[model samples]
Target: MKKSSETAAADRRLSTVARHLITTTTNNEEEENGSFMISSSPTAAAGQSVFSNIVGAPEDPILGVTVAYNKDPSPVKLNLGVGAYRTEEGKPLVLNVVRKAENLLVNDRTRVKEYLPIVGLADFNKLSAKLILGEDSHAIRGNLVTTVQCLSGTGSLRVGAEFLARHYYQHTIYIPNPTWGNHTKIFNLAGLTVKTYRYYDPATRGLNFQGLQEDLGSAPSGAIVLLHACAHNPTGVDPTLEQWEQIRRLIRSKSLLPFFDSAYQGFASGSLDKDAQSVRMFVGDGGECFIAQSYAKNLGLYGERVGALSIVCRAADVASRVESQLKLVIRPMYSNPPIHGASIVATILKDRNLYHEWTLELKAMADRIITMRKQLFDALSARGTPGDWSHILKQIGMFTFTGLNTKQVAFMTKEYHIYMTSDGRISMAGLSSRTVPHLADAMHAAVTTVV
Candidate 1:
């Protein structure tokens, strides 16, 4: 009995030891499996260390150029990187008309600071639509046009893009190649694919009419084509009236929807009507279209963030339906646009005397840009800079595409402290009488040195 009891005790001890070994082996296997799982996953590796997998985004090309320009202490530094206009002394400008308009608004003492409708102020919308599409437009007359105030040009474009994405099934938007850089981002963010059509030809230093037409012709029917109403951005090249007509016909034939971005209107040609010719033509042809208008450039109200988006439809009922959908798109993006800028624009447009004065001021600004273009052209020509400088004068509005290669542009910046886009687009408004000669000298040196 004593021996049997001892054996049982031994058996129990052995069983206890086996159980311990099994647990130890299972824990070791678990540790190995966990390490293998972590090693297998890139995400798990990233989780293992905070700084291990971070990648920085590239700097914005234009903003980076501006930052470099700002850091320079050179007295003769010229910033033509941005499109904002500057005076003869190279200072930012605020129009006198804007001041008067502000005074008028203050004098009226309009109350009600409550949230505006998603469509924005009624008077602002009415005047904005009239300004873009003639007051006598059939769409307006038939009550087939709907306008909604938005957060300046970019915001307006985003809202319009969203509206198109939600209501219209045309999933692709065709923009000009070398378009304002933000256009692609805006449309794509709104769930639409952005494709490009040929626009500027660097070799000719001008518009590629044949390429543009071919691209338009080849685009799928019912696709959306974005057109710069006037003074094409970046390139400063515009299609002639004849070319615009042809484009209009092709768009109509292909059943492609037209979206006009009229940011520069009055600032383009100093005549609002002339700048709006393209949009008016499209509207007059009884084609459904969209117009995004900004008061930033024309009214010198950049900070005010005032703009409108208008949709032209086949009938008043359709216009209402389209506007309702636009409201839905805008509600989530921004509850409502600010009131100060819209009130200022409405005040100016309502008073005939103020309106006339504002027109003169706009014309003056436009004329100054035109004169700068001429001066730059003459300066380049006098210096005998290689290549055609005529495009300087030929191009209208605030920018002049100098056709300078990237190397020449870097040379200009490094040697002369002249800041411009790598694409060689120089804002003529930034060139004052005092700096024109200096810019000309730099261009001359760069060109000759390259030769």
Candidate 2:
């Protein structure tokens, strides 16, 4: 009986220690405003409830589509929400070249798992700058441009925004009215003011060039303007080359800063040079601009998160200082980028055969997305779906702004299990010939039956 009593006492002691640990951790987390916690007792659960007041946080509109799609058990369910590329069979793709690159990397006896520099792999940074700025770029040749490897396009953008917010003379940033949803959030969280410039025209289902020009013209001198280098997201409406030249003139004339977000690159038009023309124009004019370039779409390195940020300055000395400051901005956030992805990119880009193969594979992906666009448009036409579906073909890159209202999107989701963002933006890469008919039928039904 005494031994049993001692065992019970030990159990009580352990429970008491666990409870104390939980309380102490919870207290520390609360003091730091940490977003995560665990509870071990009823009292701890009560404390967790207070911390869980994050219930008020709104769902991410873009990611929420995937969440709802996953919960649906319907086999016919379609997810055209996020801008991820998929094969015609609706499966994610990892390019053959990427596989070969990985094979080379894994087999290399000389390679080590050393940490990259704070600015990232030097070879990756140099190649990335040349890829976006062109091999013959004068600024690059003059050593007036600084490039740093970053965590894909979003991370590059956030790092650039934070630096601009702290050092740039202007804090106000003007973005497209319906840009990628995260643009505003990224800039705002970086402590910059976000403003919208009119971009899409609902009437024509195209670029509101006049409205865009007016908005940028009215922006304060030296204000930062975000430009999608190619393949504008959500709407997929990009200004023509002539329009880009005009925009460049206006921005330069007004002394406004240009910040290019080149996420699509070769994935948009199947030619890296063609996609980079807009950015090159500003660089050619010997003007200062910021560029965030991503390989997620082009290299099929989505999860690998490889990208870079480049800043053009008037002199090499200024470029050096800009890069030093960028390191300061990145130090506390993420000390350095991952080595594997950067190594893969550098391996491909530095080699002639692998680089050629990469371009071919990139073109194939772009061609597939283009094919999906044509198939979707044809299906809609065959079904005699109401309204002009020409916009599907007119749009470029991985998305088509279907212009479907929120109610129609809801109806399609409810009745057809075809999931897309409420804003009617659909990832064209997500569609296949097999699924086009289902989407077409849903559109036809929604348009005809819904008021």
Candidate 3:
């Protein structure tokens, strides 16, 4: 009896301690790293959840928009928060060219699911490099670029960040103030310091060019700069070619390293070459830079995760050495990339007929997005929604920063069942002719009623 009483007392003490620990972990975001916490209680350890320390981590601000949208039962609910493209009927798109490429891959009898090298598919790498750098690129001609297929844009960025953290001379990276939210965490966890430079000017709903110049000018020499090759996210504002030239000169003059993220390569103005102008300008100068390209947006290969990382070097020998190091970085992480997506991209890119078909399809998608932007603008204007809505037409790419405050966003969500990130960025790709009026109505109500 005495021993039984002692055991109960000890169990009570442990329960109290466990409660305290759970509270601490919850309050501190302990599971942000996907922490696996063991339970302190014998009962929990023996038969129940061992992960007692787990706090329900917050959903991703960017990705969570979809999560919330999925729960809404409203028939009229529109999810402008999703980043993927949607048809006019509000369905996820699978490009016709992508289907044709997949058919080619599936029918090829010689192809196998063998593991690719750490540098990924050789054909995919060569084609991806050519696609971004152009056919007659100086870097391509001189073999000064080392291209590696990665697990789409995020994977490529992470791999590149890891490589830069390990090999690059400077560890500090300057990203735009309002970049893809993932950028900061990707670099920070890679053991690099991430600082922000002003990019979006909310007051004018456009790029703060003067602020951008000041910020980049102030960065230390050899610091890494993350540039959205085209179709800058969130705000959808891109620098003019002349502005890009100026920015390029400043970056080169300061000897800053350029790392370009080319996610929406063909979406900005419906032409791949036009969208690639920024990255090409930097490469045209025969200087060193890094580029991460994603097929998620352009080729609609979201699930396949097709992308590549290209490191442009001053010389072929430097590029060769960089490839060796990149291989080292990749081998330990994911070992090698999957072969299926790479094959599809390669098949489409290398063939002339399919390539031509892809460009036309890409242009059509871009034209539709451009049309949606105009429709949204006209809808707002037709209602006399009292704001300068011209930015809607001006901001290029899949998104538009609506400049809606959090309260306004919440009001729209609560009353109208419209969903988007709290920061007012909406995926124009998600909007279509059927849903424009509803969105415009929500925007009008939110702007006039909430604020």
Candidate 4:
């Protein structure tokens, strides 16, 4: 009886402590004003939290860099995260041609805010196909090419994936090993099996041509392969024209379908024709292929989200049926694309003077990115930072894979106010002459101090 009484007293003491702790927590929570600590509506009287069971999703690594960079209050903070082009002053840029086109649209009172057709503007589709697949493309002249306006590169890719998923003979898709992150997600979500072919070689920081050939040769006939039309993202490594011809021959011989994601057309070589040689090579051969063209990077119409998907088939009869099915894929999702962005692109592309001016501005942007790469390379060299920095100069387009690991990336973010993806990918467009030294110092410290 005495032992039972002692246990009862201990239970009472524990209950008293638990109650005190609850009261203290409640009072502290009520006193806190910061959003980090307390909810905006802290009281239960407002409404019950219906999303209580929903788990917190992890932050997007790419976009999360921008978010973190924006939140940092440091004056020296640098954002080498997003691939969006920026002026030398580190400001987002809209091309003069884009502005001129917008003005033309604004002044033309005949233009209305009416919704576009399910297939999109006829002229925009025709012009976009011509832009990617030369003006004299026999497939287009023969009515064997089906073009549809979709969202920018990502949207175009998604729409194309959906169409392929529904109609293509095979379900397996071979993407590059170090491809744009969205490639895997987009294709997989479309209900297709995603596979990877060797592309980026870490040791050389270049293309693994032999491995790529072996992988493609081994893939089953009719398997779909995603090709970076130009200016491969993240890694910035692309196969040479000679290598591309060999790849095309192999793919054609194997009867594998090629889906070209042409995000950076004029942004790579600064010459549209030079950048499009690979796609044109495949098209010139009389086989089937898919192309997704984006105006975001080249034309600076990112917010406008203008792009198109072109399917080159064997004959006009097949293309007609394919286009009809593409309508079914788009009708349920978005129904039709936004008209303004497509209108802007169509205007500039159609006008000779504007097209020339657009190419000049596009070249300027590409040249600036190349200059930044050189500046960064020179800066790193001057500091005598360990490792071969030559890849900075060799890698093409807006991004450079810096070879920095995850821990080093975190160190740079914490010690210096520099931001980039954990995979060590930095947007060359985001770098400037002014910020090169800061990045150099941070990188030097990141590499030397850590290991």
Each candidate structure's TM-score, on Cα atoms with residue i matched to residue i, is 0.88, 0.89, 0.91, 0.89
Worst 10-residue lDDT window for candidate 3 reads: 27-36
- Superposed by TM-score, candidate 3 places the C-alpha of residue 207 at a distance from the truth, in angstroms, of 1.2
- Per-residue alpha-carbon lDDT of candidate 3 for residues 314-384, written as tens digits (9 for 90 to 100): 99999999999899888978999999889989999999999999999999889999999999999999999
Write down the TM-score for model 2.
0.89
lDDT for predicted candidate 1 compared with the true structure: 0.84
Candidate 3, residue 331: Cα displacement in angstroms equals: 0.7
lDDT (Cα atoms) of all candidates against the true structure = 0.84, 0.88, 0.88, 0.88
List candidate 1 segments past 4 Å from native: 1-54
Q: Top model by TM-score, which number?
A: 3
Between candidates 2 and 3, the TM-score winner: 3
| Candidate 2, 91-202: lDDT as tens digits | 9999989999999999999999888889999999999999999999999999999999999999999889878876776878999988888887677656567788999999
Question: Model 3 residue 13 lDDT?
Answer: 36
Model 1 compared with the native: what TM-score?
0.88
lDDT of 1 by residue, 1-451 (tens): 4444324434543453343334333232222211111211235553476544543333356667788998999988889898888888888888887898788777776566888888899999999999899879999999999999999998889898877766675768899988876787677656666788999998888999999999999999999999999999988899999999999999999999999998999888899899999999999998899999999989989899999999999999999988887887788778888999999999888888988998898898899999998888888888888878888888878888888878889999999999998878898888888899999999998888863
In model 4, the worst 10-residue window by lDDT is 30-39
Clashes of 4: 0
lDDT of 3 at 139: 97
- Please count the clashing residue pairs in each candidate, in the order shown: 0, 0, 0, 0
Candidate 2 residues lying further than 4 Å off, grouped into runs, are 1-52
